[model samples]
Target chain A: MAETPVRFGILGCANIARKVSRAILIAPNSTISAIGSRSLEKASKFASDNGFPASAKVYGSYDAVLDDPDVDAAYVPLPTSLHLKWAILAAEKKKHVLLEKPVALNVSELDAILQACESNGVQFMDATMWMHHPRTAKMREFLSDGNRFGKLKSINSSFTYEPGLEFLQNDIRVKPDLDALGALGDTGWYCIRAILWAVDYELPKTVTALREPEFNEAGVILSCGSSLRWEDGKVATFYCSFLTNLSMDITALGTKGNLRLHDFVIPFQENVAPFYVASNSRFVELSIGCEPSPSEHAVTTDLPQEALMVREFAGLVGAIKGRFKA
Target chain B: MAETPVRFGILGCANIARKVSRAILIAPNSTISAIGSRSLEKASKFASDNGFPASAKVYGSYDAVLDDPDVDAAYVPLPTSLHLKWAILAAEKKKHVLLEKPVALNVSELDAILQACESNGVQFMDATMWMHHPRTAKMREFLSDGNRFGKLKSINSSFTYEPGLEFLQNDIRVKPDLDALGALGDTGWYCIRAILWAVDYELPKTVTALREPEFNEAGVILSCGSSLRWEDGKVATFYCSFLTNLSMDITALGTKGNLRLHDFVIPFQENVAPFYVASNSRFVELSIGCEPSPSEHAVTTDLPQEALMVREFAGLVGAIKGRFKA
Candidate 1:
């Protein structure tokens, strides 16, 4: 028998919601049931522009989406200030929460959202799409191998893009009232997450921020960097900027080998990604050149990473519902 | 008409001398005339093993090599502590000096060597082979283009190698008396040089050393890192180690583009080297992927980088000799 597809109700017609809504339609185990914005016309236009299914409802207010009986899950891509209010309300309505990155303005707000989800028995996940990439899993295998890539000694990550003058002047990311964390929260989130992922999610013992951070007139960070040191002498450094050209890179060096890739956050191509690895690289005779050069490993995926993320999230929701029915 | 070749007398039988000797023989404008060691037997064996010309002289003492009339230049690959003595003597003897890196124990010693070379009108050059590679010039062109790669925003470099336990225990790089600066002077030199090269040799306004540097029992640094900031908000970071797998990388991010290369100090192959360049990279529809992805540029050279270094030094010596004779 085919399992019932989890129905998703998207909160707000945010730009990112267009991508997630498409992912819901593509995932076999999920479907878009409704989309709500502050205005019915905006929601209707968004649904029409993004090609929402005819069965999907459009709501004028976010509350209507939460109240919809067909919405088993709510994908919240609201501004940072509104995440705390809407995410908690969705959980209380017995809706699983798929929140956008920078889940909340602060840790306490995130904690409150988590508590509400636990009490209401609703699943919660941040929409970090790259985590579901098959290439990430392949890279992880190389890092976990002791003989090929021993204990990681150091890592460096950078995520930067020149979003142009119009975005810099008008984007919510640059406004202190909307996305307060700015580039640090928007782009640095990936860099910090990458470092933690390389070390198996172990928090660094010490974190020192690099000096000379560039900030806009509204006190929003335009560029910044930090150095993190682990208890076992492992070191990591990252730089995130809104003023540089697009570049997402991660370089992890180990005692026996190394791993490097330029497009870690979003691959150059959606279906295929490539990473370079070198093991036991040694200088050739007379030190004229290296003996074993790094080789590129390209991994292909049938579905987009966002679709994979949705499938994984919907599967979890289905398991919870099955347990309750049993 | 063929210009007179620069005849080189190599001081000491250090392992590095073996590579430089071959480069001297390969370079069209340079040739090995003599080699010196503490023992005549060792000097003769080194000459035979390195396949030096049968007409080349073997001296038991370094003084004899410096004093030889036929020695137009001296390739000094002695330990750091002895650089001040040998380099100054070579310059005073009117022989152009091609000295290895970490040229002195301190700035004063380096100054004395420079003063001697200036007074005697003898050409002086450090044996940093990668500086002479054609690929370095190609990468510089990308960085210099205002439309392609605007003002540099940040750069990160790393030079590391796992030389095995035997080298860690017994190598002169780990000995305080011979090479007190240790990995900082041996490997970090390359990282620092790369950062300077990217920035057009402009000095940084401030430099702060990263914490948790590894040290040997003799108080020699095995691994370390530092962050540098320029007056115009450009930042650079570098890490160098003797305990990690061989990785020499340079990732420079600019306002409009980025330049990245895995083998910066030495190419994976002596004949060809590659670097990646990305200009005006932007995310495609719905930010699913990036467009105008990084492209690789490969440069080929007939002679190895070391031979190019020797040839450049020989050309400089020939020019200086021409000036003196005029």
Candidate 2:
């Protein structure tokens, strides 16, 4: 018997779609069956440029993508402002979703998306790809081990960069309608999400926001902090900024010792990536390398996001198929 | 002409008074002239045991201590719950005042104390002795030096410890009337103060708070993050906690590199005390000796609060005497 692959469609020719659609094509048990954009010309060009399968279809509008019978799941990489509209429509059409990060502009919007997915009995997952990375799984395991980092006393994480106006002009991410979707939302959200995931999804009780508004026209926060608490009374702090050059790191402290991931925001793909663990008055460095699956081709690519997302989506599909129960 | 020393009378036989009174006796131009406590017996015994001048009088009440003509300044080391009342009384008496940390329970109480001091023209300074320590001065210098850490990005700091029940059972710090005075006020204030000082007191625009109430009966925050922004859009974060065993450290990230101070809560003293600074991608161990002018005491003996209070008070006295311009 031949195993059937999950058919996927791209909703909106978002910059993220270029990345996510590539992952979909390479993902095990998955096929990019359709592509969509606001203009038919754009969709057809993207499909042709990316060498989409001859059998794959092209749609002029996002609604047309959802209406396609061959598309079983949809990757919604629409602009932040349009996430809610398309996500609800996708769920209503009985299509499972792998929605891009921020999921929505705020928690309230995320709740609505959750409700729509649940009510329609369609599987849904936030494409916080880092959460599904094997390194994250290892981090969670190490935290649970208790001997390594001890009870987590505090967390500090940051993701920052200074992308020029030219970069912003070409990137939909810098579009103003996204509510100054500057660093805090674009990159800071990842820092917040990583810390939250490490602490088992403990929501921040109070958030003290500080923003360098001059960096962005929309009065968006250039940097911000979320002071969070776990049920065990542990505290976590998250920080993000877009006003400066690129920096991605997370440091966690505990009673017995501390652990620091030097470049945590970007996962280590090669043998040179360094992580530090300190305990009992001694510090040790560990070299971390990504382990590619046997079924996949190992291309000389710096595509941490692409590789991890494809692997994770394939696993999620398998879990839904009961190959493994969550 | 005989240089007349400023006579200092300390109210309350608090542990902090012992350090302040000693500093006063040994200060270049000061004397431990008198002592006072709620109980006359405790006041008299403390005076005799500590070797106050024969002319120094013991007072049964705080008001009596303030009334003494020999008492040029009064050191108020009462409980956290009573800082405001004593500070106000001292300010009203036209006495130079050196009040202990938190200055007051909240900004309102601190404002009242500041107003009283401003109106009376009495020199008032919070006894945050660490600020006077050479290590802090050095940290600030390193942070501001463009050749060193460069533009400040983020700050991560924590001070926590597991104290015995007796340490807090009857302590006013754990009392409900004082309102969240445990970690946030006690150790956490140091973290807040350091961050503010590091960023040159750039006030935060918005504050989000998360607290662990179980750690203190008064709902004192076990940990908190104060996100701040400056006029130029610099961002900073401060974290403090008291639930776990002691771990006091500060990590500051900058454009070129970062600096990490291990055991920041304690002074970097001689052979017995050491601190590590990570800068220029190398860890340097700092061995700091005790202040030479005071005595040949171990650097560890120099509590930040004690050193800072003494130095500031000495400067204030000089300013008031017209020997030094303010």
Candidate 3:
């Protein structure tokens, strides 16, 4: 018999939810079971617009979605402030949780959500979609190669976008009450994650925030940067902002090799992602030029990165469900 | 009438002198007249090895090169400590000076050299070769385009190279008594210059050195970095080291576009150079990917950057000589 698909109940009608809901629908092992909003009309419209199947239900409140017996998982696309409450409640109702990035305001709140999921025997995952991209794994292979890349020496990452004046004034991201961390939480999170991932999750010995981060009238960070150093001489720096043109870059330099990619967060093309790498580069005669220049490596994926993320999360949810039945 | 070529006297037989001597010979407006070292045999060997013209004079003492009436300009490639003495003496001797980078130990010594050059009516320039690359001018054109690049926001640069054990143990750059600034002076100079160039030579309001710079056993910095902030909210960070793979990168992000180059200090190829630029890039439907990907721009040159540097410096020297004669 074919395996059962992971049924998802989405909490809130967030702008990001539209993308993730589409991803869930595209993912082979996942399907939208229900969607809930503060207003029933809004939830109903979201379900129809997102092409949720006729069997999918619409609910007026988040509690009603969690109360549905057929909902195997809850995708929480709520604001940062409401993450701790809704995520824990969803876990308590024995539903797997897929939380949006800047998962919680702080580690303690995230820990509470993790603990609740552990006790209820449900899976939890942050929606860092890039992690699921095939290109990420290929880049990891190059970084881990001792002969090609050697020891990690330095890394620099930047993620920035210009979202316009109206969004700056009205978006929940810039509002202190809705997303206290603002640009740092939204954009800087990816930079920090990329640094950590490059170093195989080794925490830096020291992290110094670059002086005078830019802030808005509401006191939310508009732009910020930081430098991190490890005990073994590895160092990294990152900049994130909502004030500049759309740019996502990561450059990692090792003892014998270097890797660079301009569109690390969201690639310029959905079908193929490219990165440039140089190994054992040396200046030619007269120091006029490098003997071997960097070469571009493009990795293609059949499924979109977000859809791959949904599939991975649903696969884990299915395994957990199997364990519970056993 | 054809303009007379500027005649150059080299101050020392430093390793870098070989490259500059070739550049002087290749540049149509410049020629090597004489080379000097502490030992006559070493100077003779250097002049012959570097393919200097048969008319080129070889002298034992640096003063002999300065005294040579045929030498119109002096290329001082001596150690950083020796720069203050030789550059000032060269300027006083009425020879135009092309001093190697990290021109002096500090500002006071540099100021004294500048004062000598001014009083003696001699031209002085640091040997920063990449500034003369044709590609640099093309990149500048993009950066200065308001509609394309907009306002400068952030810049990150890194120039690093691993020169092997012999260099680490014996090179003048690592010796505290010779080049006290070590990697910061040798490599970091390029990074700092690149940042300033991106901002159109405007000095930063504040500069904070990143903590815990790596130091050699003789108390010379082997690796260092700093963050610079401007009053207008522009920020820049740079890292330079002698302990990593050969890499020279500059990534400058503006409000409307970004510019990136993997080899900014030296082009990866002598005949052509490239930089990447993305202007007005935006996400496609559903934020799947950027609509317009960054495009690579290649600028070709008939002469190598070093040769172009020699030509530019020689042209300035000729102009100054004409002014004095008039």
User: What lDDT tens digits, residue by residue, belong to model 1 across residues A14-45?
Assistant: 99998888899999999999999999999999
Q: After superposition, how far is residue A296 of candidate 2 from its true place, in Å?
A: 36
Q: Candidate 2, residues B1-326: lDDT per residue as tens digits?
A: 44457678798997657666766765666787778888999998888777787888888999998888777777888876787898888888877888877778778988998898889878887777667656666667768877546688777676655444675665556666753477678778888877778777877665545553445545655555556656555656666655454456676666544555545555433123333333333211110111111011123334333544575685676567554333
RMSD of each: 1.1, 10.7, 1.0
Clashes of 3: 0
Q: Write the per-residue lDDT of candidate 3 for residues A99-133, one digit (tens) a residue.
A: 99999999999999999999998999999999999
Highest DockQ against the true fold, candidate: 1
lDDT of 2 at A184: 64
Ranking by DockQ: 1, 3, 2
TM for candidate 1 is: 0.98
Q: How accurate locally is residue A86 in candidate 1, as Cα lDDT from 0 to 100? A: 95
- The TM-score between candidate 3 and the true structure equals 0.99
Better of 2 and 3 by DockQ: 3
In candidate 2, how many Å is residue A185 off? Answer: 4.6
Clash list (residue pairs), candidate 1: none
lDDT (CA) per prediction: 0.94, 0.65, 0.93
In the range B1-326, model 3's lDDT, one tens digit per residue, is: 66699999999899889999999999999999999999999999999898999999999999999999999999999999998899999998999999999888898999999999999999999999999999999999999999899999999999999888999999999998999989999999999999999999999999998878999899998888999999999999999999888889999999999999989998989999999898888888778888578889999999999999999999999998788789
True contacts kept of each: 0.78, 0.16, 0.75
